[model samples]
Target chain A: MIKQLILIGLLGILFGVFFVSMQDIQELYNTFGKDYIAATGFADTGSRNLVTAILLDYRLFDSLFEAGILLIAVSGVIWISKHESQEKNAQFMLDKFKTPDLFVTFSRLVYPLMLAFGFYVIINGHVSPGGGFQGGAIIATAILILYYIDADKDTNIALIVTIEKILYIAILLVASLSLVSRGELFTNFFVIDASPDTKAIYLVLLNVMIGMKVALGLWTIFTAFLKEGR
Target chain B: MNPLLTFVVILIGFYGLSTSSNIIKSVFCVTIIESGVILLFLNLGNLDGGVIPIIGDALPVGGIADPLPQALMITTIVIGSTVTALALMLCIKVFHHYGTVEWAEILSRESGK
Candidate 1:
């Protein structure tokens, strides 16, 4: 009881600081908090979507590390949850349930649409609100739908892993090529001071690679969890 | 433009975290906090009377909200959800091992070792 009280008191104090700090924050538009980069975002990045420009072009390094973090976390989960009972339980799960035809039909109907929409989002990341992460998540959901349709059959995990590796390596290759071209990494090498067509192509390529890597990585993680139980 | 609402939500999340002993509830509290923080960030970027920051001939140059915070929040939301999912997975593993997910019970079981 004492410990709980202490926790509450500590939280109250912390929130008090937040409440006090909020008062000082004026409306962002009236103050100097204007997004100055957004003013020239299209000129600099050739992306109509300012958020995508900030994400892929300005802060590409951070996004790469975020993807890496997800990889590490999923790997950790797979590593820690290993047990003999889990294998048996997963096998039991496979043997117990029959796939409903309705679910199968529904998934078949919607899965292709989701896949196409995901690709469209990744392809048009620069032109629209959707980007690599969002598109990848959608594709991952589509993979999840595929999983639901046929849980008994195991897809080629090795192939997915290989594709994920190739995509990551491609991203690295692009980054290194940019480094070589401009003496700095992720320099928007083809975008800045380049023609319109190549700039659009470069951004699209980056977004596509990131999208594929993210989708494959997430699908692998989900399957790893599904294959094991506990 | 009011940050007070988001702050209140964050405080509620903190309170939930402080009170909860269940691992699942803890995950929920963390998610609530993450959502509150995201809301706060989106609010920070929003102008008092502004539009989305998409650029085109139809959209005006001025009155656009800050794009940086919204962009950062996008990645932040993804990362937060992934972390919460993993945490819940770990909690399941713990529950399977110890037959309980309450922190006090888990602690007692570990201490018995």
Candidate 2:
């Protein structure tokens, strides 16, 4: 009872602090801050989507480290869940799941479509609502569906890790290419000066690299969990 | 999307964090807090009659919703998920060692309290 009172008291204090600090959300947003991005972001990054422009171009360095964080997390999860030699042939929890026949059939039907949609999102990131991270997550979800269809199905984990690392390097190389092209780093050079064609290509290529890295990283993390104690 | 509502969601998460005995429940509470934060940001960045950040000829005359918060929160969401995954992995290790996921149970077993 004392613990519960303390918890409630702490929460009340925190809530009061947050409430007092918060401004009227309706009054806060004005033309000065967001207008600039919405108005000129397209001209600057040559991407129809302002959010994507901000993510991949203006804040490219942060996005790179974002992928790095994911890589580190995947590695940490795998390390912590590493199987002992004695458990090499142990039964997996994933194998014991009794998936219904309806799920299996539906998964098979939607598998190809989900994969295609993921690619579409990545490819059109500069033009539309979806981008590398979201698209990659969708692709990972698609791969996750595969587990439901065939619990015993396995992937070459090592190969996926290698591919993810390579994609990360490729993303770095692409982001830095601006340094050689126009003596700048992180910003897409084509977005700045090159014709529209090259701009789209640079943005799409980067999106694809980031997408693949994220997809494979997430899959690796899932695989590590499924393979735990085995 | 009221800021107060957003804060309430966070407060609920904190309440759960404080009271929940299960390690997995605590992890879920942390996730709730993250979601609350995300909602708060998106809410604060909202405009009254704003359109989507995507630009076109038919763009509304009022304004576009703030894209900065949305972009930044995407980073936050990814980081939050990674944090949750790492925490859950730790929880699994703890479960394996102590054969229980309750915080009080683990501590009592560990310190012989």
Candidate 3:
């Protein structure tokens, strides 16, 4: 009985804390009013979306670091797969497509549309909510569907290699351009105001490159797992 | 509904994390938990009547939703995706190494060694 009371008491206190926190947030909003944006100078960056400004400009170094992370992950996966390839082959069954013909045809019809949608999202990321990461996942979904449909066929290793090369080249180009335009090399150079058109072009190009890279990288990793798990 | 729903989601995620035996399931639970935190943050930062946090001559005089939290959430989402991917990869590695995904079996086998 004593333990039950203690539990109830704890729950009540937690509820009280939550209520107070919400009230505090509301109070803070009341206090700040419109002065918050005026003080931030976010609109001056030429990006209408405040979130985009922060992501592509304000904390660009962090974004570059994230790209580095993708590189490291891809390299690590490659290393691990190479080490375990021989072991994986003996146990793996590369041919396992037991689905109906109708399902395969449906997936084939949907795959191209999905890929196009992914590309659209990547291209329009600067002006919208969907960005490289979201689009890349969508693209990977398309590739995965293809892989499932054609399990017996030789995997499209060339597609993955091409995407990887393109991404590396694009990253290098962007990084170099940022370095040259601004003395602060690793800063978010894409936001620098040469022209609105130029910035938009660069943003779209970077998004597409990153999207392709992530999609291919994820596809490779998943295929490696499927091969090993079989 | 009230923002309390966010807390409920968090609790559900915690329950999932604590009870799940499969490594992959636990990783997904962690993603759910992270998403709950993101939702909570977004809710906390939202103003009752506000506009997007962008400065212009046409700006409103009323409250403006906090841009900082939105920015933080984007960063959090990216980090969360990477972490979840790495966790799944780790689970795959564990499965490859031990031939089983149950934490108990793996632990017992390691202990016996």
Find the candidate with the highest TM-score and give its number.
2
Report the CA-based lDDT of candidate 1 relative to the real structure: 0.77
Model 1 docking category: medium
Task: Residues A1-230, candidate 3: write the lDDT tens digits.
Answer: 67556655665676578777776664455535225444543443455456555556666566656766665675565555555235544223435437688988999999999999998887777666666767888898888788667764445544675677677667667756777667666545654556555566656666677777778767766665565556
Model 3 agreement with the true structure over B36-61: per-residue lDDT tens digits:
99998877666464676654445557
lDDT of 3 at A46: 52
Report the C-alpha lDDT of model 1 over B2-109, residue by residue, as the tens digit: 677787799889889878989999889999999999998888777365777788845564557878888888878667766766886788788888999898989888
Q: Could you give candidate 1's per-residue lDDT for residues A1-230 as a string of tens digits? A: 89878887887788788777766766323534445565667777788888888887787787777877766665665566555453443332544677788989999999999999999999999887898888999999998888677776575555877777777877878866777676778657773687655677878988898888888877877776776641
Q: How many backbone clashes does candidate 3 have?
A: 0
**Which has the greatest DockQ?**
2
Model 1 spans with C-alpha error above 4 angstroms = A1-10, A27-35, A83-86, A89-97, B57-61
lDDT of 2 by residue, B74-107 (tens): 8777667867888899998998899999998898
By TM-score, how accurate is candidate 1?
A: 0.89
- TM-score of model 1's chain A: 0.87
> 1 or 2, which is superior by DockQ?
2
Question: DockQ of candidate 1?
Answer: 0.60
Question: Could you report the DockQ of all the candidates, in the order they appear?
Answer: 0.60, 0.71, 0.35
Question: Model 2: residues >4 Å from true position, as ranges?
Answer: A23-30, A86-91, A94-98, B57-59
